[model samples]
Target: MDIFIKIIYAAISILVATLYGLILIGIVHKIYARVHRRIGPPVWQPILDIIQTHGRKVATSHGIMFFLGPVFRMAGGMGTYLFMPVIFGSVVFSNYSMAGDLLLVMYFIFFGQLGMALGAGEGGHPYSPLGIARGLSQMSTFELPFSLAVISIAIQYQTLNITTIVAAQQGGMLNWTLFTNPLAVIAAMISLLGMNMHSPFSLVLAPQEIPIGPPIEMNGSFLGILQTNRALFASAKLVLFMNLFFGGATNLPIMMLKTFSIYMFSVFIGAAFPRFRPEQSFRFFLRIPTLIGILSVIVIAYL
Candidate 1:
């Protein structure tokens, strides 16, 4: 009975997260449109797009792996969301956070990417491979600084459990890791720009050159699954950042505001800058952010 109740709670949490994720994507599109001085789609545009994609009559698949790619992607996104404690101490919103720690969260976040890469290889499209190569290359580059920053925070808190980390920051805003360990925050936020795949780091999607890259061949229902994953994955990443650097929110409204603010960091940067070449993006992450991450580790060790 207890296990069944937990499962029910988990299901509800995922559903809510999915809805919130879609709304956030819609809001992001609206913001992007406003920046360009154009009328934007409705705030519910993402939901409509997903529905249309899912309703399409035909979809092409390239072997079993190609068919499974989007499935793996959705699983990855949902799994990541499930493991995160959404509203700090809320019982129903906790999801399955006890099943994993920060290390597992990091691994789960990359699980979908690896699955998608395999599926892309099976996609049998020349551009798909090219996009995969660029995406993987950039992923490797950014993961260094991001991982190091996470390690620094883990060391400082002496626990890989995200709940405990959030609990530690409860007293005041200054107690947040962002204020207490600015170096790690800086390193992480910089790497986050690449993770978000915004301008300057948007080489992976290179629509003009690669026609939207790895998922180029995916259409109809498959594309809809990928679209759904996009919403959940984006929200999960934002929640992870909020838990690590900003203090985790105690309620739904605060959570939305904090997550949106963190998301805007990438949006504003993407809007103002041009895209970077794959190699340029790689080298950029290796430079300043890497140095800051290393310094953060050293500072934590001394203290």
Candidate 2:
């Protein structure tokens, strides 16, 4: 019965994540339609894209590891969602939260990225050369500030558990860490934007320049897993961000609303700006928000 219950919850979590992906794709479709002055695919277009791609043939290389890459990447992401707390509710894997710290979570995020990078590089496509370069460059730019911001919060709460962090925000919006340290929030937001591969910071693909980045060489069922992985990881990252600062929702609608709101806000910002040059992105991360993150930590420590 315990195993059955966990399975049921896991399935529900997946369903919720799928619906969230559909919503994000739908919004992108609407935004593109408005921008190009033409009707776009239906809201369910991404769903169709996923299904159609799942059965297509893929070039086999790197033997088993090539296929294992997406599997491991997606599995890691899915396991992360199980361990990560949503709202005040305990997650199935929450019991192990004490075994690791926020730093562990941060490392796991890198693991997910590394998996994609390895798979992309191993695919033997010269086209992905620029993609790999951009990905590494982008990672260097974003990781510092992101790490500092997490450290700041971890220090403030004196614990690395996601649940405890959310609990700290219980008095209402003002008690939320965002209000306590707006600069940290800003820095973290900048980092999150970059991490999610969104614009301004989204130099990895640079639609006008680099194309789809590391995933450029991929197709078929492998691409399907990649798509699902991206969508699920994106949703999980958004939720993690919210819980980190704004606090997770006690209600489902509000939680979804928060997730969608963040995603849309990201899209709006992405649409508003052109891509940054590699050097420009590096400087922005190192000189600007990086300093802000440091200062926020200092300030929050005093308070």
Candidate 3:
């Protein structure tokens, strides 16, 4: 009975996170449209898209791996969200937390993308492999600064448990990692621009370069699953970043506010800048952001 209740809570947590993510994406679209002086679809457009896509019949089939790709991607998004506590003190919403959860969360982030890559390879589309190559290489490059920043915080908190880290930030804004270790936050937030795959660093879905990259052949439910994961994965990344750098939220509204604000960082940058060439994007992360990440770690360890 107890386990059953926990399962229910987990399901609710997932639903709430998914809705929040979808809404956030819609809001960004609206914002982007407004920035260009055009009316945009309502904020509920993304939710409608998911429903519409799911209703489509798959016209063709790939192999088992192709079938499993979206499933694995969804699993990766869920895995990323489930292990981290969503709120600071609310047991019903906090979800789960454990030692070394940070590392696991990072792995899940890459894991979902890789799953899609595998499925795309099976897609046999000539462009799928090309897109996969670009996406993977870009991901590997951005992960460098991100990994360093994560290490810096892991050292600052002296633990890999995300809950403990969030707990340490409670009581005031100053207690947040943002203030305590600004350098690490700086590094992480900059790397976030790449992780979110916004302009300049938008190499993976380089529609101009690779015709929107991987999942080019995905249709119907396969496309639906990938789309859904896009929201889930984006929200999971935002929540994790909030908990790590901005201090975890105590309630749903606060969580929404913080996460949305964090996401805006990328959106604004994306709009202001044009896309970079793949090589330029890779070089940018490896040079400045990587240096910042390293400096952050050194500051935390020695200074």
CA lDDT of each candidate?
0.89, 0.75, 0.89
Tens-place lDDT per residue, model 1, 1-303, is 998898998888777778888998788788888989989999999899899988998656589999888898898898888887989999888888888998888887788888898997898989888888888889889989999999999889999999999999999999999999999999999999998887889878755565788898888888899988888888889998999899999998898899999999998999889888899999999999999999999999897
RMSD of 3: 1.4
Model with the higher lDDT, candidate 2 or 3? 3
TM-score of each: 0.97, 0.90, 0.97
For residues 1-303, could you state the per-residue lDDT of candidate 2 as single tens digits?
976886776677766776686668677767867766878778887778789998787666666656676876787566556556654565642324445546666766777667777777777777666687877777877988988888788888888888788888887789988887688888888887787766687767654464777777677988888778777777777777878888777767777888788777777777778878777888888988899899888977886
Q: State the local distance difference test value for candidate 1.
A: 0.89
Candidate 2 differs from the real structure by a C-alpha RMSD in angstroms, to one decimal, of 2.4
Residue 249's lDDT within candidate 2 is 74
Q: Please identify model 3 stretches exceeding 4 Å from their true place.
A: 206-210
RMSD values for the candidates in order, in angstroms, are 1.3, 2.4, 1.4
For residues 91-135, could you state the per-residue lDDT of candidate 3 as single tens digits?
A: 777777653489999999899889988988888888899888888
TM-score rank order = 3, 1, 2
lDDT value, residue 154 of candidate 3: 93
